[model samples]
Target: MRPLQIGILNVMHDKAATNARFTKVLTHAGRPVALHFYYPKTHYPSGAPAEVAAILAPLDLAAAERMDGFVITGAPIEQLAFADVTYIAEVQALMAALAGRAVPQLYLCWGGMAALDYFYGIEKHLLPHKLFGVYRERRLAPAPLLAGLPDEFYAAHARYAEMDRGQIEADARLHLEATTASGELLLVDRPEANQTFMFAHLEYGREGLLHEYQREVTAHPERQYLRPAHYFTDPQTMSGPQFRWEETQHVFFDRWVDRVWAKREAKEVSA
Candidate 1:
């Protein structure tokens, strides 16, 4: 069988790290994969190190259309209005183009919020404080992507904006798959469109949250930020960011890759 073609539209400042992280997750899908990384020309950061930028190709709709699966990685710009995002227009165009195709798409974090707003009318709202931590979410419904995941699974979240839960519950077009104890959205499925929206970071490394917290605190000494909850072995000492979710993370991505392959196979049969 030919390797599955997967496209990753990476918008984070640490381009190389994001690329390596996603590459590690998707490669565990039990099949060979050919990974492609893209960066929006209109919004690529100006000072990106030459070495990191070299790994990314300019976002091309034509190339994106041919992929068996596509991933839109999270950005740190959730505080801004979707319309205010510099590359919103281009991103919207890319998403619209993919809307009519069969390619299975995965939208993560801020990317998930963007898709929720663009595909549905559900908007993301700011939280009183940043929802940083490793949260345990329970399955709200059955989904191919949720297969093998335990009843309650832990995933990391580090964001200030959240999807409208009421809107998600009321919309017949969306399937609310999983949620935290406090009713935050974790996994949502648009089965009709073959798109999955993941509000947390299942792809984060063991110390991902620890590094993020340290970086934020160091970057903004005047700002007060809480240490990510349920993450460190000792929050006070900030040691051991226990990777309790590693198994579940691998299972979820494996199932996702299978779903994309299944869709491709079904389409081939019909054709």
Candidate 2:
């Protein structure tokens, strides 16, 4: 089969690091992939202008149906209303351009919130406090996507809001596929709607959280950012954060990539 063609609609201010983090995880997944970067021209108040950067690639809508899958990475504007997001108009247009295509889209973090809103009309509600930590969710069903994940596994989370579970469960097109023991929903998707939403950052490497913490602390020391939970090799002293989630990251990406590959082949078989 041809290398899986994945599209990244990146709106992160620090594009280089986000790109590298995703590359590392995907490369480690051991799947042959052809990545296409589409930088939207919309702006984020807290992020760098979605302006033209040498690294940003113009989106090729004509190639939508050819892609094995697409990914919409998270942004930092979760607190804003969807329509208020600077690029929502452009993103909506891009989604329209790809209408009728069945490419699987994986939405991460704020991107997940956006997808939940755009595709399923599901809204996100603010948490009492930012849900910033390493959280573990148990798989809720048997599906190809959950094929090799541990019964319960950890991943990094950095978000200020979560999907409205009542809306998600009541929507016929969506399904809540994973959740924490406390019953907080962690994963949801509308298979018929061709969308999957995940609130955590599965692509984060060992220091992703550390760097995030460092940056937040430097910018807003008054926020008194707590060190993420269950993330350190030694909390009392010494050493860096433990590399607890690397293997789990690998399994999740591997399964996801393989799922995309299977979709590509299945289409070919039917044709």
Candidate 3:
């Protein structure tokens, strides 16, 4: 059997860790998946390391075409508009290339916003509450990408902006899958091409959330009002810290892998 060549377009703010987490989940599924990472552009004036920026500076359409599957992850920084970013043009070009292609893509957080904007021509707006912590999302409907998940599942999320449910409902092409406690759209899928655009971070563990919390505290201590203990109050589980986080990741990974593998099988048979 041929190994699945997964091309990951991971950008700044612990993107390396994000890709590593994702790879760990997919590989643990017992299938062969080769991962290729697209590092972020370095000279980005956004405080990202110059070394990392150099690897992504020359990122182009050619880099995207080499993968069977792709993932565009969240970035640490963003301006009001997509055009404001230094690599926006290149990223736009890359998205345009993927349109109508059979190659599946899973976009999380900012990438989800960008994908929606690219497909439907609408921008995301800042949400009043920065959704910063592990949260639960209830699956509204079943899709190939969410094949094995329960009606409600946990995904790590930390964002200050969001697009309303009305926006997604307005687009006939986008299928809304999951929603938050306040009825916010958390998962959307493009059924025609087997692509998923998730506003929540399903690729995170407790450790990931802890690292994120530290960054937030370091940047704006006032915002430190948000704490893991608030979400994971159970001392028994949350106390171990690292072990609990790893276990959390494993549970979600099992579900994610099953879903991906099923989709891969269906696509191959249909092909």
Candidate topping TM-score: 1
TM-score of each: 0.96, 0.89, 0.81
- RMSD to the true structure for each prediction, in A, is 1.5, 2.8, 3.9
Whole-model lDDT, model 1: 0.87
Answer with 1 or 3, whichever has the higher lDDT: 1
- Indicate the TM-score of model 1: 0.96
lDDT of 3 by residue, 65-163 (tens): 655667788876543577676676666667776664656677778888887887787567887667766566677777545555566566667777887
Candidate with best lDDT: 1
Report the error of model 2 at residue 14, Å.
2.0
Model 2 residue 45 lDDT?
38
Please identify model 1 stretches exceeding 4 Å from their true place.
45-49
Error of 1 at 45 (Å): 8.7
Extract clashing residue pairs from model 1: none
lDDT of all the models against the reference?
Answer: 0.87, 0.74, 0.66
The better candidate by lDDT, 2 or 3, is 2
Q: Please report, as a residue range, the 10-residue window in candidate 3 with the lowest summed lDDT.
A: 239-248
Native-vs-model 2 lDDT? 0.74
Alpha carbon deviation, residue 119, candidate 3 (Å): 1.0
Q: Cα miss at 227, model 1 (Å)?
A: 0.8
Give the lowest summed-lDDT range of ten residues in model 2: 43-52
Q: Model 3 segments beyond 4 Å from truth?
A: 40-58, 222-225, 228-230, 234-271
